[model samples]
Target: MSAVIESHGHDDHHHGPAKGLTRWLYTTNHKDIGSLYLWFSFAMFLIGGVMALVIRAELFQPGMQIVEPEFYNQMLTLHGLIMVFGAVMPAFVGLANWLIPMMVGAPDMALPRMNNLSFWILPFAFFILLSSLFMEGGAPNFGWTFYAPLSTTYAPPSVTFFIFSVHIMGASSIMGSINVIVTIMNMRAPGMTLMKMPLFVWSWLITAYLLIAVMPVLAGAVTMMLMDIHFGTSFFNAAGGGDPVLFQHIFWFFGHPEVYIMILPAFGIASHIIETFSRKQLFGYSSMVWAMASIAILSFVVWAHHMFTVGLPLAAELFFMWATMLIAVPTGVKVFNWVTTMFKGSITYETPMLFAIAFVVLFTIGGFSGLMLAITPADFQYHDTYFVVAHFHYVLVPGSVFSIMAAVYYWIPKWTGNMYDERLGKLHFWLSFTGVNITFFPQHFIGLAGMPRRYPDYALQFADWNAISSVGAFLFGASQILFLFIVLKTVMGGKKATPQVWEGSRGLEWTVDSPAPYHTFTTPPKVSL
Candidate 1:
């Protein structure tokens, strides 16, 4: 194949994937770095999934089967930490790396070497975190939420390692996000303006800003916890006049946006897939951007909603309740936009579109649950229970994770220039969608029926749902193995992909060479529209 195979964009030159370990160590190429982020995230996802399986296993029957109580605590802690920082966050960053530069018609990320450095920090950070599992006591066993006092005075010998690792990870994310923001701000091709840029880019730009603003706050919170742990400061020490509740506030302040951080790029992806398969101009395209921005801004204010049952004062509760509900308006606008975009259009159920459609239906269910969680009195019943767990897992698994699957399905052809086995892809999708619903849906019932979260065992009354959930979890886990096979098989070789990988797709990314040329297309494509 000649270096220049143009179906979507004109190419004047070519480059190849970076050279060696050092190339990986110091890579700046957007695709190379994106590949690294993605591979790393997938590994972390499986690791975290294993931990979750352990959790589900212990909860599967009514008693602790395979793990000790302390070990159970450790499993819960590491699972949350890894899944949040490891699986979910990195997946979005990986998407940003792969799509943002291409989506906005940029040459590559703005700070390529720094990009390398940021990513390299992750293995070390996670190493430290995972290594803590072997220490004398155990890894930090407070939940991944890691509230103070528990995380401070009573934490294990490994808390320091957890904090240090988190610091490095935060640094990595900040750098990655900064690169995305800078690349989008500066690197667009000749005719691509702000509005003309893809929704993926816009969603990530907002996501990146959110990352920059909040990751540091998280670092600071941990640093404060470290001081309270070792340096003997009172930041979260009730004895020294510090308040534990204050820690929750700060944590959630970072956390709430962090949740959006996971899903915003997903919104971008789901939007792209839905529009492509639906064969419609994205309904209210500008409105979609505005809605995302609105969600981002609103995310910051709703952190306290997560803490409502903490016994906040009446006014504070009222304020948070309403503020939380207010987020629905913009979110509803986005959901409506997707539905309306699909409305009256030729709809196809290709794998990418299947995942996209699933994301809409399931993510809305998650969103509705979130609304229910936001109501002050209602949350009193649901808070700290499996209800909350079910709500978030829905948003994340089907919500963020499914969209990631959609993105891979959508773009595998472009990257590999080989069609993924559609039959295999559909198999992966159905198993995943079914497994996910079975895994999470019943938990909502269990939660409302009073199943506490972060527990390894439950009473016999909760046994049935937990058993069903665990089985679904296993199937979900096994289904992902099919996904791995499909992606790997496609990458190894398959039918050749056209430049416009999908018949209805439109983008600068598609304009580039399939299995896109290294450093090619320095001459950006002129926007035809």
Candidate 2:
């Protein structure tokens, strides 16, 4: 087989930016679509962050200052919906779109038409969701978890739209994951066997499986909700012979693994950056892969942990607690491997590495709290409080979002054929780091003090911490403006980059030329590490 990639879709006719607004709509190229997904995700993140600020501002001094209880409920609901569906998930898929082809030595996604469908589904899905805000009863106020009666009988006029929109979004995820799985499995360069693939690829492959498995379950759960609401079937109503608690079972069945799906690719990104900046091989690469797979499989068995407060049988609670606790074991292995990778290595505090290190310390802190929540008795106190809020934000923000930022920093050079503004990048990191810790670290303390989450206001005792948290939230929210500026500038132009953007970076991506062309590795470049 020839080592050189020369045909490169010599006749397929790439559909991407021809220099303006029409580009995003017409594009089918993975990089172009990836950029679209990322920018859209960021836009949703900003919208969601505004809602969070409103929530914080309301709680700062207590007593319904910013809006009514009803309005505050809307803010919380929108914040959760936008952040979950619009921000984290799409960002990871965007990374998959950009990196999968590059890493596997494919020119583009396997099914370009399906890839386009996936990207387009997002805008319409979000439109249906956001439109709910204007309906007579307002957007979903039942919380992001959307438990049974809360989403069915008691839900607003908008629930119908939300259900159909979610169906579309789930279809989009399924199609997107299918494209990625096919691309990686079939399009890998010669000799790039499954086990020999990069950890990032390995992690996403697992995440795709998780997505296919659970997204359908989410679809099923929502379908039941729609049926219970309109047809009076009562899948969740005891009067009609279905149990409300059953909703929690099904929702969390999808929800627990949903959390893993968001963070695993983050693990992949952090591992790559940590190895590169530390000038070391990823510690226990095979073990890292196994750890992720273990987490995915374990995620399915532990869904009941989320429902301990709903009066489960003692035996059920105990079983769920044990299952949830077991997840911590594989998770701990991953944390240890990252730290070991850093140990005695020539570590540099580049922006990406900085974010990766923060992810380790902070996600571990979150994990410890998660394990605490797994205890049946302990969860009684922690169940609906800000502690759960604090735990997940630490995991998702510093853990997943930070990793996304870091990946952008790490790869912007290779993708743009130019180095980003390092000074500005470092400044963005410190601002984000300080703002995040100030924002969430104190919530742990407040949770211990018994402050609950999702409330618009709080008691006087919670005032001082809430005040500090609001400040941090604003700082963090605004700092993203700097990131937007940095990425826009980097893509425009800077110092030229070589094929090997980072000196220690590995894999087939580096074998291709910089700012990789419209087509790449058409003949599947051989990996020779």
Please give the lDDT score at residue 83 for candidate 2.
91
- Clash count per candidate: 3, 0
- Ten residues in a row with the worst lDDT in model 1? 1-10
lDDT to native, each model: 0.89, 0.89
Model 2 lDDT tens row, 1-529:
2212322443356543477876678777788888888888999998898999888888778787878898899889889888988999999999999999999888888887789889998999999998888999998898999998999988997999999888988998899999999999999888888888888899999999999999999999999999998897979999989999999999999999999999999999989999998899989988999999999999999998888888889999999999899988889899999999999999889888888898889889889989888999999998889889999999999988999999999988878888899999999999999999889988988898999988887888988888898899888988999999999999899889899988888888777778877677656787755
Residue-wise C-alpha lDDT for candidate 1, range 1-529, written one tens digit per residue: 2312431232333545557787787666778888888889999999999999998888889987999999999999998899889988887887788778777767767777678788888999999999999998988899999988889888997999999999999999998888888888888888888998899999999999999999999999999988888897999898999999999999999999999999999999999999999988899999999999999999989899988877899999999999999989988999999999999999988999999999999999999999999989999999999999999999999999999999999998887789999999999999999999999999999999999998778888999999999999999999988998998999899999888888779888888878776564466767756
Instruction: Give Cα distance to truth, residue 39, candidate 1, Å.
Output: 0.4
Alpha carbon deviation, residue 445, candidate 2 (Å):
1.5
Candidate 1, residue 527: the lDDT equals: 72
Worst 10 residues of 2 by lDDT: 1-10
Question: What stretches of model 1 exceed 4 Å from their correct place?
Answer: 1-15
Alpha-carbon shift of residue 68 in model 2 (angstroms): 1.1
